[model samples]
Target chain A: MLSIKNLHASVEGTPILKGINLEVKAGEVHAIMGPNGSGKSTLASVLAGREEYEVTEGEVSFKSKDLLDLSPEDRAREGVFLAFQYPVEIPGVSSTNFLRTAVNQVREYRGLEPLDAVKFLSLMKEKMKLVEIDQKLLSRSLNEGFSGGEKKRNEIFQMAMLEPTLSILDETDSGLDIDALRIVSNGVNQLKSDNNATIVVTHYQRLLDYIVPDFVHVLYNGKIVKSGTKELAMELEEKGYDWIKEEADKATV
Target chain B: MTTITKDNITDSLLATVHPNGNSEAAQVIRENGFPTTKHEEYKFTNITKRIESKIQSFQQAKPLGLTQQDVSKAMIKDLDADVVVFNNGQFSAELSSLGEGYAVTNVTNSEAPFSIKDLYDDSYLALNKASFEKGVFIQVPKNKVLDKPVLLLNLVKANDGQLITPKLWIDCAENTEAVFIEQTVSQDEQAYLLNGSVEIKTASNSHIHYYRVQNQNNEALEVNNLLTDIHRDSTFTSFVLSLEGDMIRNNVTLNLLDSGCEGNMYGLYLLGGKTHVDNHTNVDHTKPHSESNELYKGVLADTSRGVFNGKIFVREDAQKTNAFQQNNNILLSDEATINTKPQLEIWADDVKCSHGCTTGQLDEEALFYLQARGIDKKQGKALLLYAFAGDVLEHLKIEAFKEYCIDLVQKKLGTNF
Candidate 1:
């Protein structure tokens, strides 16, 4: 469902991602684990089309469409979603309002009619139960004054609302507690299907226990040095990323 | 610009009809000689240049009849409120529906006296007093809560250098609650001058919410002076939203005359083109244990210029006074300018007083956050601007007015978010 070829990106002329490639098929879940500054978040931001990060040389194709040529909003309309590591607090705009605008925009791009208030509210109520979010929180401003766990859960809630085909969870388990991690991961697992793809980017292996992945890749210095199954995540967690770094250094030499 | 001498202006008004109780104001105008830029109060907003450069005589403009098309532009549809329409500065009884608890009367026929004694010396107030031909006096009785708002629609037709001085005096009796909305709009792009004055006297324990909206055409010039005297235990909340005008100046003086009074002044100005809007607000904490809060924000695009000067005074006898003032601005273009000043004078030792001012652009991070969420750039910018003005709009108690303001702000930004 998605392909990245020799992805080279930078921010302010400082190279971050260099010589990276990855592929994900439909109905499959992929886990990209790395330490800090290993380009895990950068990959998420580049896929989300954050203008600050310039892709100097790369080719990203989503569903056989050239994704690099599209803008962030266009990418989003084309079923590309990035659950942010740190969600933005948009004051004065309620969560429900934001979700409705996003959902309608995506639907409009897909040549579908916009959902009216009654239908939209029902969809929102059904999705809120997945993340165990309070109805009152949806009425408040989006992420404004929300707790860390609440923000993570709200991200999952938005993901559920949009139902993107290629979802990238970038460090989604960073600020969440154990209970919130279970709930958020449970929501992601519930939304998984045969037609959609998921990419779980994380620094720890704790979140993988809830939402198990089909493949595990260790990203070190912007490139995936080792690819394995679910046991690789546990191996990295037990032995740490230092051995992965040494192995990457040896490969470079 | 031709210098307008006091004798020239006074003779012109006296030639028409010397109304009673205006002689003292005329004398003050003669003494002040129409505030020049040298005057501290008239530094940023030079009314002298504004009036002399555009208009010649301060006579009442020829009253024009309104058509079906004009009514649509004049009134807010779907607004559940009592609407009062004024045509060319004259109250149109046929176009008005003022419900109970509201006694609307023309100033000339109303036996009750109409006067503004404290502001007799101020140039704008004195000018309105000297030459105002048509005015209205709206009175709300004691212990009554108005069922709906009273919307005073002040519409100005195409001008032949007309000087419209619409004076309004609102007396909200003790323990009363009411919302008064004054909307000033021009029909065509006529270079007319609207010199307006409103004096509201709120009795003890009364609650009054006043909204002043200036959506005049680009060629119109206006100077609106609002003086509100808030009595003991009364709460006076005011929001002034300025949309467009060539030059608009608002002078708001809120006097917390007695103890336990609370006053709030909130304003938002969305300016573009060469439009200039100046808001000068003064809050006087006269009695002890009174509180006052003031915040005025502005968004200046193109070459628009915005000026905000907020002053809070805690008098010597006013102990335990709490006063806060803030003015924030966002300049979209490099040429867009904003001059903000916050002044606080506390003669009382036991008082809590603070003031702050800032001028900057919109948050780039916030804009990107919206744009990344499938909202286009134009809609993203509008969302950010809406968030910037959210706090002020949130304070509006009336939902219809709030929606109207949101629409105006969106239209000003050239986007509908």
Candidate 2:
């Protein structure tokens, strides 16, 4: 469903992701994990077409389309979603209004009819229950004065509404409590299907406990050093990334 | 035929003064002449130059055949209010409807409540006093709460080099509540100058809300002076919506005369093209335990220019006064400019006063966030600008008028509200 071949990315002349090669088929989840400054979030930002990160050398293909060539909005319209770690607080726009515009634009891009207000409201109500979010929260300004948990849940609510083909969750569990993490994971699990994919980027293996991944790749110094199964995550939780760092350094030398 | 030059502009205007005009006001205008850019008050606004270049003569134009249909077309749709129409600053009795609980009369026929002596320093005020031939005096009796708002629809249809002076005096008696909406519309595209003034007096325990909407043609030059004297325990609130004009200057002053008075001034200007709009607001707290708040926002596109000068004064006897002022602007184009200044002078020790001004472009991160949600760049920008304007739009009390203003803003920004 998605492919990244030698994707080299940088920000302000400093290389962050160097020669990253990844491929994922349908119905599978990939987890990119490493210590701090391992270029985990940078990879997610590059995939989402953030203008700050310049893709210096590589091509990213999603569903046989050149993803890097598209603008940020075009990327979202083409079924690529990025759940921001720090969602912006826009004080005047209501959450419902924002979602309506997003949904209609995405639908138009997919050659589908736009949903009317009644239809959109019904869809919102159904998704609201999946994320355990209240209607009052959606009526207020988008993410304005929202709590940490509410913001994360709203992101999931948006994800459920858009139903993107490839979902990238960047540090979603960083600010979540135990209860919020459980609820968020439940929403992501329910939204998963045989034709969709998700990439979970995090530093801790605790998030993988709720939404397990099929492949776990350890990233260090802008390169994926090791690829393993779920057991590697448990092992890394027991021992820190020190052993991995030493091994990677020796291999480089 | 007299050719009016910049040096003889004042003489040409005074030659056509009304028979009831004040001699002292004429003397003041003769002495001060027209303010130049060197003057402190008119430093940024070059209204004299605009007037000199556009208006060749100060003679009144021949009256265009305006009727009730023209007034109705310019009115806000579905607005439930008492309507009064004016054509080129003259009251059109055939086009107006006098509702219950209020009396409207010509200012010259009635006992005028406004004096030019209080505002002797301004040549524009003197010009208005010396040349205004037609003015309205509206009185609301004591203890009467008006059921509907009063809409003063002033329509302008003038030839080149013509001048229109619209004057109004509104007196709300003690313990009364009322709302007034003053809207200006140009019937033609002729270049003209509108020198207008409004004097409002809210007695003890009265509450008044005044809304002024300026949506004139591109060739219209306007200078509006609005002064309100708020008495003890009264509340005076004003909203200025400047949407379109070639050169527009609004001078709004509020005097909190007694204790327990409250005053609020809110303004929003969305301008494009070569339009220029200047808002100069002053709030004076004269007695103890009074409060005043002022907020003005502007969005300049194209090569448009905007100026906001907000001044708040707390006198020595006005102890425990609370005054706050803020001015914000957004420049959409490279050539668009905004000069904002917030001046606060407080002589009282026990007072809470703060003033600030900010001018910048729209937030790039906020725009990107909206774009990331699948909205295009243009729609994202429009949404952000509308939200930026929400700070002042939220203060609108009338729902229909609010929606009307929102529609205008949406149309101006080319997006949905």
Candidate 3:
């Protein structure tokens, strides 16, 4: 469903992702873990088509289409979603209104009819239960005074509404409590199907316990140094990234 | 008619003055002449230059034969209010429709209940006082709340260099409640000048809401002076929405006369092209326990310019006063400019007064967030701008008017949702 060949990217003339090669098939989950400043979030941002990140070398393909050729909004319309690390606070736009626009635009891009207000409200009510989000919170300004848990849950709610083909969760578990993590994981687990994919980008293996991944890759110094199965996550959780760094440094020497 | 030059504009205006004009006002204008850019209050706004170029052929031109269809086209659809139409600065009795609980008369045929002493300082006020021939006097009796609002629709249809002065005096007695919407619309494509003034008196324990809408043509130069005297235990709220104009200057002053009075001033200006709109508001807290709040927002596109000068004064005897003022602007184009100054002068130590101003472009991160949610760049920008203006629009109490203003703002921004 997604492929990256020797992808190299930078931000403001500073190289961050260098020669990152990854592949994910349909019906599978890929976890990319790393320590602080190891380019874990940078990879997610580049995949989401953030304007500040300049793709310097190599190419990325999603569903056999050139992903880098599309804008951020077009990327979302083409079934690519990025749950932001920090959702912005828009003071005057309500969450319901924001989601309605997003859903309608995505539908239009897919050559589908837009949902009316009554139908949209019913779909929202069903998704609210899945994420355990409050209707009152959705009626207020988008993430204006929302708690960290509520914000994360709202992101999941939006994901459920849009139903993207490839979902990239970047540091979603960083600010969540135990209960929120459980609910967010449950939402992602339920939305999984045979023809969709998800990339879980995190700093720790704590989220891997809820939504287990088929593969785990350790990123260090803008390059993926090691790749293994789910047991590698437990191995790194027991020990840390220091051993991986030592091994990567020895290989470079 | 004499050719109205920059040096002789004042003389030309005063030549055919009304018989009941104030002599002192004429003397003030004759002595000071029109204000130049060197004047402190008119530093940023070159009103005299605009008027001089537009008033060269100033004359008492005949009315442009405006009809009921023209008046109805400018009216708010489904608005059930008392409508009073003023065409070319003259009251159109045949076009006006009055309801119960209020009396409307010609100011020239009756004595004004209140004096315009405190508002006689400016040159525009003096110009309005010296040359205004047709004015309306609207009175609401004590303890009576009107069944509906009063809509003063001023329609100007002058294609020549005509000068029109429209005046209004609203007298709301004690224990009454009233809402007045003063809307100005132009019906021509050529140059003209509209020097207008409205004086409002809200007595003790009364409440009044005044809304001013300026959606004139591109060739119209408007100078509106609104003076409001709010008495004991009363509340006065005013909203000014400026959507279109060539050169518009609004001078709004509110005097809190007695104790326990509250005043609010809210404004929004969405301008494009070479349009210029200036809003200058002053709130005077004279008695104890008075409060005033003000917020004005502007969105300037193309080479449009906006100016906001808000002043709050707390006198020595006005202890326990709470005053707050804020002015914010978004310059969409690089050439668009805004000069905002919020001043608070508190002579009383026990008062709480604060003022702030900010001018910048819209937040890039917020715009990106909306775009990431699948909305296009233009729609995302429109949504963000509308959100930025929501704070001022939410203060309107009338639902229909609020929706009407929202529609106007969306149309101005080219927003679909």
Candidate 4:
């Protein structure tokens, strides 16, 4: 349940996302594939309400509410989750504590009482299985001294805990080994429901193999130049974004 | 090398001398005299300003804020601790109780064989003796493992007048185990000075856990020192959390007297406004096979300042010694400053010793990531600060106290997160 029209955003007065538009319905997974500096991340960041970027034009709506007007925490409360390409290593904040705060914040927004500690721990145990994360890891600081794979897996753990209505994962599979990719993908797959949506933002097409997207859009120069089925991801991966770049040049000519 | 030799720190310290120019403690300061900057220990933090700006009013004012009930209420949950309450610098029997297998008695002004006979430095130690109100002498008998942590709650409510000296001595006997928790707090905004000393002696095979919490009033200033001696195979853990007050200085020295002795120290200091905190720690590896590890972290905001100088000295005969020390700090405002030094002096070739110190701002990249995840700047910084302080907080062995420390730090940061 998301809609964007003529989206124009910038950072420090420099144009990034210009005249871009996209729409996605509930329960649909959309993959935005773009080469470097194509404004894919800016779109994701603007949607999550990062303050650095100025929304010079266009408006976004989530379930018909003005998205741009909401604060970051408000967006988080409204079930907008972002999986950072590089997860932050929050020293001294145990994984369990971070997730608990996030889950309770989300739950509070929905008018739900915070989960009791016992109930919370059990829920964590159940979720940890989805990502193959160890209990010992949960006991330590969030992502501190964790391997790249562990950090990626921890992101899925958080997504599981918050159970957001929409999750925008930016390169969740960038550093994962095949096994970790399978585990992370499986986690995202299990957390998906018919009432929510997903946006997979990545530099590679391998992640789409496990949780196949409903629409594969090739993004170039702040605009989605082409839209196709899952085969499009395979085609882009096989020949690379050069084909998309060439096609954009041909259009300009 | 003489006792309390005067140095350059005292010359530069002459400016801030107040109107009266003295307290019973200041008289001691003038007599015992200020140690120069060349004094190895006082090198990093220039305490001259503290000496010259000394307010005579602090030493005479009666302690303010807390009553006996307030202290008893704050004792550790379910702990059968020997409760000693010090209101300002004076010990209150009406507010104290000694636990089983232990004896807690006030070391009154008239007490015999008082170390008052062999004084250390000026008013810092002597003021406690000249007009000292109360002190505790704790003795845990041989081989007894007391089941609870001793509670020493030093409350300085508020006062207009002078200084409060809280004094303590603890002797945990051979093969005995004990835990001690001390809290220094003030509720009123009255300006005062606190000079405190806690001396501990651990016998062979004994285990001691010491926790110190400082949450004094915003107008208060304090200088506290602790000397701990560990015999063979003894273990000592000391953690200090400094949160409030205008100025705070802490000195902790651990002397490992026998082989197999161990020392673990972790401290967290959070300062804002014009508050200042200086911590000096010395871990001495005297006997062979002794080990010591120390980590102290601070978060400074506004114009507040922090100083950390930790020294690990391994004597020539102390072979196989393992000593590690780290001091890290974060400054929230550009005006905030941290002067940190971690020093290692190892004479034994077989020893493993390393010390590191870093002063920095919070990671911008990490902050951006949190913001991109829909967390605002304030919440993101709070998360990182908590994470920074979390490194030391993790060493807390008690769950409730650990949570208490985290909450206290968060409140000090003045953020809802």
Candidate 5:
């Protein structure tokens, strides 16, 4: 479970998230639909504890604990996972090596035993098959020359391996083809459980078709103006953001 | 002593060389000065800075404990081949192993009827020739194949108030092959200086791999001159790794004397806490159809200073000679300074030669990627920096030397394991 109360964040003194307040309970997929420059990414990054953002006023609690006090690495260990929009490419470090180290670090932080190589490889095999990822890609350096879809699939694969309590996918389906989108979305759906939550952030409603959400919220000018059932995403897709803009104007007037 | 001022030490030292032997190499240094900052060949390294300031008489190393048991121990290690181990610059013959293909003899006089050729007037060689108490001669016969890599352990005892000057020579006959590892290590953390010279000659179609690990004690100074000559179709590779010392200088030269020869020079130096290490490498493409490559990397921290100078020269007759050189360094502290220069001079119009050098800190993007994976900042930096210098470590060729490099890097990382 996660709660954001009037999240006011900015980057380089320029306000991006004016006021955002959302609450997501367990076993629910919430879609935050936004046009460009709507603070969707700023929310994901601020939650992930990116140092560039300045939180002027707001409070975000994850699992009933303050998230602002943790560093990015600490936040990562605390079951707050952000599937990066653009995954970083680290050369000379193999994918398996990178993931193994990350998994063990998180496990160690939570006072759990680390997985051995035999168990880790089996887990990776099962997850890669679920995400339709090639095993050869995992043997090479981490995303050094990976294709667009392969990178997205790799992100989902990592999500399955880490098994975080709350996962935020910030535009994971942007560059993916229909097949990759289906596989990635299917992997996310499979990993869903009654004790965890998910937030799907995107600009289009195409990905929502595969991974249905409990609630759809339209974000414009840094604030969520409209919240409804899944039908709200279909309405925004057909009528465009102009209708949301009009409703937002009436609310302000 | 009047001729030994720091300002004109080059001319003073070379001017006093008593070169009465048949070697024209020794005669040349007696006329011209020692390598100075004014010399274009030695411009980047500034070897004169250290040599000129220390004006003691060039005498043989005189340590307190040069017992016969140390010589016998040295002999046990090199039982199969011709090897000369030096402890504090004294040859431990009692511990040496001599082979049938080679004859270990002391240079009683400079004018011996030997097949060895001293072609260049390198002042360092002449200085070694003039001052060293003993020298080692290792020879491999024609068409011979050495199955084992020779280990020449040059040990500097701790707290031994001794200065060392080591002179070594190796000759490979035509179509022969060998690998030589010359390791320089100290037992104690004492202040001593070593002036050393090594000369290698490879016959046509032979190949040699030479590795030198300069992990002297922190309170020691090491100055080395390594010269190698490759004949037609011969190949030569050298790896230099420097770990600890106050002042260390590694001077390497490769002469591609014949057509279709190949040469490679690689080194990695990790220094901290006021350590100063300098690597100067030169590749001379003298004949056509030769090839050469060189790369040196360094990581310095805590007021340490690193200097890397790589030079490649292709002669007019050396058409089709392909040469490449690169030097990269990372300065971890703001006060840590790195001086790097990659110079190339090509006289042949049809040569493929290129050179590059750079100095900076760890790659920020790479650092961030590692940190994002939950790796702590200290370990992340260490891993990326180690990977940056991996190329040099991999090229060590010898298994022990490679493992030593890994251990050294891991130790440098300290308790952050």
Candidate 6:
């Protein structure tokens, strides 16, 4: 579903992602785990087309099309979703209205009819159950004054509504408690299908227990230094990242 | 630019003064002359030049009449309101219809004792008091709740540089509820000057909603003043919408006469071209336990200018008063300008009062966030602007008017998002 070849990225002329390569087919869930400043978030940001990050070299292909050539909005319309670590607090814009606008825009791009108010509300109610979100939260301003868990759950609610083909969960488990982690992961697991792919970026192995990953890649110094299965996450959590950094230092030498 | 001095303008104003106008206010005008930019209130909205030229031609022209077609064309279709029309600054008996339970008469002819000295002020109010020939007195009797709004339409029909000064006095009695909507209309590209004033006294236990819409022609300049007195336990709410004009200045004042009164004043101004809008509001909390909330938002494009000055005064006797004021502005172009000032004066010891003002461009992060959600730049901008104005627009209780204002803002911003 997605392919990245020698992905070299930078922000403000400072190189971040030096050389990275990854590939994932449809229905596969990949977890990118690393310590602080290991370029895990940068990879997600670059994939979501954040304009601040300059792709100095390399290419990303999604379904045989140049993904980097499309605008962020076009990338979104093309079924690329990034659940932000910090969802913006847009005042005066209700969550329901924002989600409706996003859904209609994506549907319009795919030559589908727009949902009316009644249909949209009904669809929202059905999908809202996936994240266990209260109906009252949907009518309030988007993410304004929302708790950290509510913000993350709202992102999952949006993912369920948009039904993107490739979803990037950037630090989705950073601020979640055990209960919220279960709910967010449950929503993600339910939305997974054979026609879609998932990339979970996290610093802990706690979230892996809820939504188990098929492939685990340890990103160190802007490169994927290790690739394994679910055991890799547990191994890193038990032993910590010092040994991995030592190995990376030896490899650089 | 015609060469006309301040003395010449003052002489012209004195020559055509109304016969039944307030002599004390006329004397004050004769002494002070027209307010210049030196006056603190008129510093940014300096209209001495326009006033000098426009008032010259206005004093020389004859009073122009309006046809029913002109009134019909300017009326909002299907508004089901108690319509009151003023043509050329005079009450149009042929155009107005006072429905059941709505009473309106000429204040100049009313036997009820009235005094203009209590409402007099500097140049604009003084001028309005001196030249207001069509003073309307609209009263909603005790314990009455009107189902329909009282629509006051002031139309200026390209009357060869006529000066239209219309006056309105509204009294919502005790335990009554009413709505008043005042709108100004004129022909396209017609130069006219309007100095209008409205005085409203909301009695105790009454609820009043007043809306003032200034959708003037591009060649028109208006200076409007609204003075309201809110009694104990009464709620007085007002919304001012300024769409387009050459220059418009609004002066709004609210006096909380007794305890437990509430005052809400909101404004939205979307201006472009070389147009200008200035709003000055003052809320005097003279009684204990009164509350006042104000929010004024403006979006200026092209080379237009906007000025806002809101003052909240808590008197020494008014303990435990709560007042909040905020003025926010967005300048869409570099050439557009805004001057915002929020003033709070608290003489009481146990009062809570705060005032804040902000002037800047749109938030880049918010815009990019919207665009990242599949919305384009234009649509994203319109959405952000709509949200910015939502602080005031959300207070519009009337459903149709709220939608109308949303449509107007969307059209002005060039997007329907």
How high is the CA lDDT of each candidate model?
0.84, 0.88, 0.87, 0.78, 0.77, 0.84
Give the residue spans of candidate 6 off by over 4 A.
A225-235, A243-253, B1-16, B19-21, B50-56, B60-70, B107-120, B202-204, B230-233, B272-274, B300-304, B330-336, B358-361, B410-417
* lDDT, residue B107, model 3: 68
What value does the lDDT take at residue B208 in candidate 5? 90
Top TM-score hit: 3
Candidate 2 per-residue C-alpha lDDT over B243-315 given as tens digits, one digit per residue, 9 for 90 to 100: 8889999998899999999999999999999999999888989999999988899899989999998888899
- Cα RMSD of all models vs. native, in order, equals 3.5, 2.6, 2.3, 5.4, 4.1, 3.4
Model 6's interface RMSD: 1.3
Docking class of 3: medium
Model 4 lDDT per residue over A1-253, tens place: 8999999999999998878778989899999999989998889889887788999999899989999999877787788888878788877767787677667766776899989899999999999999999999989977999999999998888888877888999888897899999999999999998998999998889889998999998889888888898999999989999988999989978
lDDT of 2 by residue, A113-227 (tens): 9999999999999999998999999999999999999999999999999999899999899979999999999999999999899999988899999999999999999999989
CA shift at A221, candidate 2, in angstroms? 3.5
Question: What is the lDDT for A241 in model 6?
Answer: 97
Ordered by DockQ, highest first, the candidates read 3, 2, 1, 6, 5, 4
* Residues A1-253 of candidate 6: C-alpha lDDT, one tens digit per residue: 7999999999999999988999989999999999999999999989888888999999999988899999888888898899988888989888888889888988999899999999999999999999999989989998899999999999999999988999999999998999999999999999999999999999999999998999999999999999999999999999999999999989999
Say which prediction, candidate 4 or candidate 5, comes out ahead on TM-score. 5
In model 2, state the lDDT of residue B204: 98
For candidate 1, list the clashing residue pairs, or say none: none
Q: Per-residue lDDT tens digits of candidate 5, residues B282-400?
A: 88999999999888888888888888878788999999999988888887889988888777888999989888888888776566555555666676777677767876777766565
Q: Per-candidate DockQ versus the true complex?
A: 0.51, 0.68, 0.73, 0.42, 0.45, 0.49
Tens digits of per-residue lDDT for model 1, A15-79: 99997889999999999999899999999999989989999998999999999999888888888
Best by DockQ: 3
Worst 10 residues of 4 chain A by lDDT: A97-106
Sorted on TM-score, best first, the list reads 3, 2, 1, 6, 5, 4
Report the error of model 5 at residue B194, Å.
Answer: 2.3
lDDT (Cα, tens digit) per residue for candidate 3, span A77-157: 999888888989999999999899989999999999999999999999998899899999999999999999889898889
Write one digit per residue (lDDT tens) for candidate 4, span B141-187: 99898876677877775455546777888888899988888877565
- If you score just chain A, what TM-score does every candidate get? 0.99, 0.99, 0.99, 0.97, 0.98, 0.99
**What is the TM-score of candidate 2?**
0.93
